[model samples]
Target: MGNALTTICATSDIHSPQYLELFKKALANSTCKPDLFILAGDIVEHNNIAEYRRVLELINSVHPGIPVAAVFGNEEYVGSEKEYVVRYPNVIFLHDNYRVIDTLTGRIVAVGSRGALDKPTQWQAKNMPGLIKYFRDLPDKISSLISQAASTNLPIILVTHYGVTYRNLTGENPAIHPYLASRRMENVIVNHRNVLKAVIHGHAHNGLVESIDIDSVKVYNVALPARGRIIKVEV
Candidate 1:
């Protein structure tokens, strides 16, 4: 019933300290194979497709053919011009999309939804319509999972680049808190909470390291814990 991870690494805002070497060390140094490797968000400081490509190559080198799922933080949004990072294989980028990883232990459903705000200054209340429509549209990234989940007995992991609940926005901007988190997203989560095992989010760097309650399901703020730490979600 808890988000218990036996072996895995989670980090966000990893643009600094150049984590490529450190990530390799963690994978090599560990005795057990990692169940997952997650980059919460802010993987890159600015939108640099070249850097994204390099990061992808470096990660593949460390854990070649390993499945690594990631969500883009606000910093990663670069209009429609950025393509290399979003299109890379091996790296599953969640943009309102979901993926199911059928592991020996259990099945995992990973869905990611993150994009620009119609008007960042307007805040949450005003963005409900657009947000809901976006939700209804889903994304190519997650289309397959919508159907796959019907036939499989897998635990669902809702992954996203934004913080959908206010529970995690503890240290975030008070005036902008409404804008930082998603109200429309909250509605979607609560509706599907029963089937979801947990949710992983990025965006709120200053958010609390706590679990959010989405009806019966527990959502987690998996942003980088300072650095070199991973939160395990064991079902």
Candidate 2:
């Protein structure tokens, strides 16, 4: 295996101008401009599609051609249905689905959902969509994509909007801990441990950028407050 692909990652609770500036600075200072620019979710506070469009426009301005894989967070909830607007060429929103991007070294499979962590216990993933329903029906939807990703036998990078384990749940209220992350996510992810090389998520601002080896698959919390950060994963 050679060195993994490099990319920038950051989580946002709500949209702010400060984030756009930080992204420019990161791009200016970095020796290698990220191949992929990832937004973990909660792009804007209000469900206003206009604001979402504006943010996406700004993001495209900063990193003109880089592919950005993003998911919506709970706060992005506006009235009823989830927002689905794809104007920017680089912006790819992963909701109840995944996308495959072919690369030179190998293929990269990116799976994400806006409200994925609200499922039932780890043991109840099979019923995650029906009876054990909580948040996004990702656990059920991700099965086919994961199977295809693993079938390729390439190093896969899982981009998500929610933390999979409590290791990244530090400095959060104990009362809302369960609400922030669910054990069902850990189960669904661990089931395809062989395919996934790493998992990155947000929604926990004070949480640490930590990694845990679940049956050898590494999960990372990529949220860095309101700033921009970079990460490179090797196959």
Candidate 3:
């Protein structure tokens, strides 16, 4: 067998106190302790500072010393509070950046992007259509980051708030597909399949918890509503 690291716990869209409790209980009851905890996105319902702090505090209280990494969701716009979360001793907030953590298996690198969408669907097509243009370049930026990470020759995990592959949006409305993910980002992951361990994303709460392999790289949709349990992935 290949050198695979076991038990990287990933969860997303934790918006309620109950969901936060779910993580605490899951960790306590887990058969294998997680090497890393990845909060893909939407940790807070509306980017509430208190909620963000509560989640971090809960993780620290329940599973202290575990490395926690996160990316912000659409609900959480760029702000100082987003920066504040990373100040916690054990927290690493990834906003269009990457982090490398050493594990028994080897060096594992995680790259993140809040990511961008293609276009809104008819049902949700309103607001600032013009704004979509502003974020049009995000996919390219993410692609470059992933490429840089791959050059490190480390096992890579891509975490994002937006879906990368369309398969992750399987359970959502077909009309809203464009708005939920980025095809360009998926293309990058597909191109760099050799170094990619797994890709995890949220924002499609009603989406599938299934894993679809793109050239041997596994992509998971770990939104809380889609996968209630903390997803364990061997890197």
lDDT of 3 by residue, 27-83 (tens): 566665677878888887765656777877766676677778888886565565445
Give the runs in model 1 whose Cα sits over 4 Å from its true position. 1-8, 16-33, 53-65, 78-82, 85-87, 104-106, 115-151, 225-228
Q: In terms of lDDT, which candidate is stronger, 1 or 3?
A: 3
Q: Per-prediction TM-score, please?
A: 0.70, 0.74, 0.85
Clashing pairs in 2: 4-233, 4-234
| Best-fitting candidate, scored by lDDT | 3
Q: Rate the local accuracy (lDDT) of all candidates.
A: 0.58, 0.60, 0.75
Clashes of each: 9, 2, 0
Per-residue lDDT over 1-235 for candidate 1, one digit per residue giving the tens place of the 0 to 100 score: 1244434445555553455455445445644455666666667666654556656675566656657777777667535334744466557676655667644344577766663322354433364445545544443324345445635556666676666767667777666665556655665666665566666666665776567677877767765533234456654
Q: Cα deviation in Å at residue 225, candidate 2?
A: 1.3
Best by TM-score: 3
Which should have the higher TM-score, number 1 or number 3?
Answer: 3
231: Cα error in model 1, Å: 2.2
lDDT of the structure predicted as candidate 3: 0.75
Cα error of candidate 2 at position 213, Å? 3.0
Residues forming the 10-long window of minimal summed lDDT in candidate 1: 115-124
